[model samples]
Target: MRLMTIFIALLGSVAVPGLAADVGFEEVKITNGAEPPLTAGIWYPTNAQGTSHSLGDFTQTVAPEAPIAGSRLPLVVMSHGGGGWYGSHYDTALALAHAGFVAAAVSHAGDTFDDQSRVLQLWRRPEQLHRLISYMLDEWRWHRRLDAARIGAFGFSNGGFTVLVAAGGVPDLSKIAPFCDVHADHDLCDALQHAGVERHFGSNVPASAWIHDSRIRAVVIAAPSFGFAFGRAGLSSVRTAVQIWSAADDRHQPHPYYDEPVRDDLPRAPGYHVVANAGHFDFLPPCDARLSRMRPEICNSRPGFDRATFHDQFNADVLQSLHDTLP
Candidate 1:
């Protein structure tokens, strides 16, 4: 009875009204040459009303297998952070879905939770995202219903780095060792301490590998990693409108080294937001009780801070940027 009561309470907590129009959900798979099949979730506008659909311990207010709403819609491609899944930002995806946009998130083949083989390989990220976009535009079932030219990207953490490359930014692996030497205490430095990144990855990547996709017209990214790698020259190449969000107290990647450089160096004026007293994980969707128990470090916030409330505004700002830029 106690367990049942707890389950009921958790259910009620996440049962809030969704934004704008109703959302439809579907699971899609894209086969990209020899790489593992890319599993993605697509959220889009739908005329059918939605009901709560439970997946594992979490639930989303969506109509599963519902028909598409309009003939052609703007597309938003999402890339999750390191060790993160595509649904890490479901609320954001839902917001885009309700706002008459088709939002799809591809699970980066070797960087996701199930696979971490290539998490340290920085170049593979943009390449994988490129293939994902190509498949979505050229081969996905809904290709005919999508407005090819009106496309944008959303990313978080390392995924943030991926979209920037997709938007024409280049990264220099040479900068990492020097950055780690100075900030050895940082999480990024500690993670690479044992990897021998210089000998293996440094010499392999070409100085001018083309990673940009002209199809992506706008981009929104949060707490991007390897910011110093882009420097000014690499970032200046990015011509698309960008919106960047930062957590005031991010411990993992931290500021100045991560989000600051992008703000200072990008030639294009970017829409920036800094959430006071919030941590890095606060940028992720609010936690349910089950998730709170499973990952308290990320689920808990400062005494007065609320992740859900912040996301309401965060989602709105992102939608406005994409709508304004992509249109």
Candidate 2:
């Protein structure tokens, strides 16, 4: 991993100047289910008249409760990694909003850090994503100003896997046993081990299920989990343009066993990128001082790597990809 870091540093890639806007922010409650209302954070382009403010652990150049800047703007839905909150990619969401996109992200019911009851239920993630999309387009007050035809999804890790499923890739849960057998030390394996495979996938569970949402016109997936589960046949129905990203030094799900196989097997070639000096958690936003002190392992980076610097480039690449693919 360290060697890979040095190799990337030698490549001399640097962040470039790009588009930006004064972002607007809001917190929403989505009542799509009888269980509990879903919590989400929404970001969108606002007239440059609003003041910057902090949202919980992160501060952004966005004003709370600001009015919309433009009508019929593009929309991007975000899904966070396993055990992550909707605010996991708050920076990226803000970037999208500044780039003339309306972005919203929801906290998975039982899959978040505070709850793990339904984390083992593979279908719940995609279902929740689909529900969020439905609510955003049909019930949200700003739905009228959103361009329905130009919609995209963004995700990382397990969230990445969800976007693929929502984009029409069906995973074979039956392959879990064999995957775990080979990747015994992998994080996915350990998660299943603790959850108990039998409890997660019962006898009635089918080998394949359709979880696609036609509303999602494009997707940007990063360091997806359970990539091997989607073989060529499983991804055959996915027709949307996909932007897939992998880290050269990801060890949690790893390159070989998780993300690479998905990119390689997709029916149509995806716009793929491998960040040389990055790790599984690098796709996440750079942590604040308080967050760094609370979680050093997730906040720390390689000797010369700067997550904040890399994200500037990443945001540009993502904005361009969405514009090109969804336009």
Candidate 3:
């Protein structure tokens, strides 16, 4: 069966121009945010030539090899941590794409580093996820490339919280008391209010849009924060299967974010994984010498953990979960 699958995959590659080569990465402009339109990188199996171009300078950095074709591929949407861009998880996206899945990493407009406006950052994430999913479904229906039946979401940190929201893990915003003092005209305060961060939906975007979206087959969260407030009621209500993976030594966010609360809640839901030695930054790309020199403090958290190995293993686990859960 494996050999037959390989043969069919090779035949499919020959039929499609860039179907069996290394993964191809392309920046797709998605109109989903308030301003500074969201941009996401689409990673998919490509032909040899397309693969070469896709790898480009990333060959030395981190690039994922292509996967065999023939089988119907799943679709995975990746959301990055707070203040992170789509490029931060580029390698992870490519890896999933090469593993016979279409992976898209979105750069939330307000949340990215380039645009540090707190207000927009908080307000736009949910909307962006909703629009992006809608767009992907439309693409699958019209382009005839993606398998709409198998779709999942994977998010890290703030993105992790967003995935919960996408999975119907709605928290009572009132529970998220301000970690700091707030003043009038403060963008952070206003943004948080607008996003219903400490509350629920104040607008027409129904909570059902996430819980009831039949297209989203599964959800995977990494080092999810704010998940504690999204109690069992919210988590248990999700129709789609869920898999959460987190690290015990995550410094940026409290370990309890995963261990005590989130993990405690998962048994009632579906699946979850906890890595012992992992850190918060393990999901991102490997830090280069330049980053170490320029921002030592940031890279110093995970002393001996190998970023490449961690991300690769994490993605592999995610793919396995998707394969088991989704169609």
Candidate 4:
């Protein structure tokens, strides 16, 4: 009798979708008053028709403010890399939404494209993700349409570091100064030096402040920054399913210091991939002609590598990982 009552209540909040459904898109504000307001872009499944819209570097076709097609759907919150915004991976978010999952990405206030205030403040990113999830499950207008138990995350570069921490991995940021001291000539180290990063950047912050939320069941991290920070000890508490990607020919934060540590340290082997001849930014959505010319460093893949082709498979793989892991 009790089980039947629960089932009936679940059905009451859900709406069945027709055979044809398009992606839905909405930009929402997440403000908790403890920090700056975060502007988030959400993509989800909807029965309404959609039209093409340009969003910064990428274009998307989604039904604006369309009511969700179904109830109790899964959610995947995205975290963009340093200097990136919510639209950085619009294609991935849309793909997830089309596959019946709510995908969202937030523009990290102090570390976004126009603001580099907290670019090196790695400790802050995880809390931003934690807050985003809290809002989606407890405050979003469509909260009841989501299955709180099935939530995942996807991130790249510094954003990769964020998801790792959110999944219960504790990075020993103290390793940064020492690693950079020895490998200052490395691409990532050189860039940090150029960014005016101080050696003791995260020293004042207490260790407990590096936030983690157990709610995230799965994660996809690509070409993570500060990868050396998560040694075996740092990754000891991480219990979520993980898929980690690294660009084989990445010049920015190459092997050994970047993805290698997390790969070898995680308690269990994560689904790992090393894309041959790919660079760090290849993990992002395929760029249009204008963006390609404007930011060749991020847009261009290595010789004989096709980014558009790779992304098709990448997006498919990400969806599959979430499907396999999320209940």
Candidate 5:
């Protein structure tokens, strides 16, 4: 593993710098009058050199608040999974920045690691992302540096469900109870029990809550939860191109339950990839020592799997997919 990590670093030197220059990093508190300030992290290309810096437990080479280097750069708004934060896909964000795109990830309020109060309220997620895109294109300090027409989205797990809706797919949440009743052995059912979520999570959510933004030209979704809910009819309206990913051995949001339905139901054929020997949480980056100790479940891959190596290809593929659609 140590040797593989060294190899990954070496590859970064050769694999990075894909369509742009050095990477810049920064955080923002988006304050729109209609909602509480949102916490977000952004990565973009820069002409300035960046030094290795610690952001909480993780470290990355980033030019902090460096001057914007590119004009009208492509923008990608990221939505993290339930109980995840903006940094959940930090490595991917950095890769996007290195590839000349501005990547912004939001710590979905009330559904983040620090709070799960709105975890079951899936309808609000796409709306949150919509607001995020609006803030980036209209209010962000670097708003003028972005190209609104080339906007895209990337999401994982719950976030997967989110970007799909934002791209005009509607999920029939009413399918939850019936599905759960039959698949009671699934981890999603167990998670719901621990989180105290009622099966009636779909009730009373007006159609208006599922906001759709046609501006998101493309999306990349990984192991989306609640996939069954997006039946053929529900996913019929999604015209935006998409790239879908699934872990072959995912234990959490397992097969035919999560990624399958979306892949099968989407009106347009999506670019899909399933990683062999990968688990559900393997979609996250290779964990740091401290993070591994704290959450080994999400950190460790199967005996033979190498996450650091896989993410190299993963990031490149994600980058290519975005550029193909957004450009």
Candidate 6:
């Protein structure tokens, strides 16, 4: 694990230079069904130039210690992929803040590598995302720094599925046949059932919740997991505009998962982009040298795509879409 951490850090240090900026970070602890809590990293543009700020070891806060001048900046709630932490998406968050939006990436209680089992982590992810959104709305209102009407969500992999559900793109968990054989007694299966993923994750929310709530105005999903095909009822329930993008060579979830179903069910308001030679990990900052040294697979996957190039273009596309869509 130590090696893996170093690998990811090295990746970020090397690859992030081209896209990185001075984004400030802060910690916000939210309840995760249990009392003493889970936390998230809130990244935003800073007022100070050149100077850097550090939140703590557990939390990687960077940039100017002072808050920047901005009123009602559009807010984006980001969800990292499986086995990831809030700091993992620093590049994305910083990019968005520099582009003029405040980005908050939640460190899901059960999903992060530090504290939770894989199964429990996967199961609790979607609910955590919703709760985070609800909590952020209140925070935004009180802080008066977020434009509630211009909220957006962007996520990758499992986190991708989180935003999909938030955006009203429902999946039928019962029908989610796993490609790899997982044991029935496995925590993964148990957690999946506990979360009621079949009922909520891929399926649309109730009509009442869908039509009345306007906090989430748009969504962007990258290599979203879960089947892309929306049920007839689910497709009809979607009200928010969406932007979907995926790599042609995504080794993790593949294009078929989303491409086919979205083509048939996604409404006309949503936009789609495909990166010709990208892979799943491209969306994340590079793996640090330590991890890459220990596990080569962590750094480079089955060949073809250049992770750095893919992400550079993907990040630009995401920023552009949000700027145009979010007020």
Best by lDDT: 5
TM per candidate: 0.90, 0.90, 0.76, 0.92, 0.93, 0.75
Model 3, span 1-327: residue lDDT tens: 222233244443233222344565556677754566577767776543432342322342223343334345677888887778877677667656555677777888767867656622333576677767777667532235677788898888788877777766655444444431323233334556666564333334344444334567788888776665566775675667877777777765655544357657653555767777777777666667767677565455466777666665676667667767765
Candidate 4 lDDT tens digits, 1-327: 222233234334433221125888999999847876899999998889999998886777889999888888889999999899989888888777777789989888888999988788778788888889999999988999899999999999989999999999888777878888898888767877887778667656666979999999999999999888889999998889999999998888877788998989999899999999998889988788898899998888888999887887787778778878886
Candidate 3 clashing pairs, residues 3+ apart or interchain: 18-46, 18-47, 110-121, 173-198, 173-199, 174-198
Alpha carbon lDDT at 170, candidate 2: 87
Give the CA lDDT, 0 to 100, for residue 244 in model 4: 94
Query: Model 1, stretches more than 4 Å misplaced?
Result: 1-20, 194-200, 208-210
- What local lDDT does model 1 show for residue 292? 94
In the predicted model 1, the residue pairs found to clash are: none
Tens digit of per-residue lDDT, candidate 6, span 1-327: 232233244443232211233455667888766545667777776654534443322234356444644667778888887767777677667667655578888887656767555442244566666667677767532356667788888888777667766666555554443522333343334546666544334233333332222467778887776544355555665577778777677765554655446545766556878777666666666555666676464466446766655555566667767766775
Better of 2 and 5 by TM-score: 5
- Pick out the ten consecutive residues of candidate 2 with the lowest summed lDDT: 10-19
Two-way lDDT contest, 3 vs 5, winner: 5
Q: Model 1, residue 192: what's the lDDT?
A: 71
Query: What lDDT would each prediction earn against the true structure?
Result: 0.81, 0.81, 0.62, 0.84, 0.86, 0.61
Best by TM-score: 5
Candidate 2 C-alpha lDDT tens digits along 1-327: 232232234234432122234777889998856888898889887775557576657776677887787877888999998888899898788777766789999998888878877776767788889888888899988889888898899999889989999999888877887767777788788877876665236324564554689999999999998898889998998899999988888878776878878888988899999898888899998888889998887788777889988887787678778878877
Report the Cα lDDT for candidate 1.
0.81
Lowest lDDT block of 10, candidate 1: 1-10
RMSD of each: 6.2, 5.5, 7.0, 6.8, 3.4, 7.8
True-vs-predicted CA distance for residue 248, candidate 5, Å: 0.1
**Quick one: RMSD of model 5?**
3.4
Per-residue lDDT over 67-121 for candidate 1, one digit per residue giving the tens place of the 0 to 100 score: 7787568889999999887787888888778767889998887888778888877
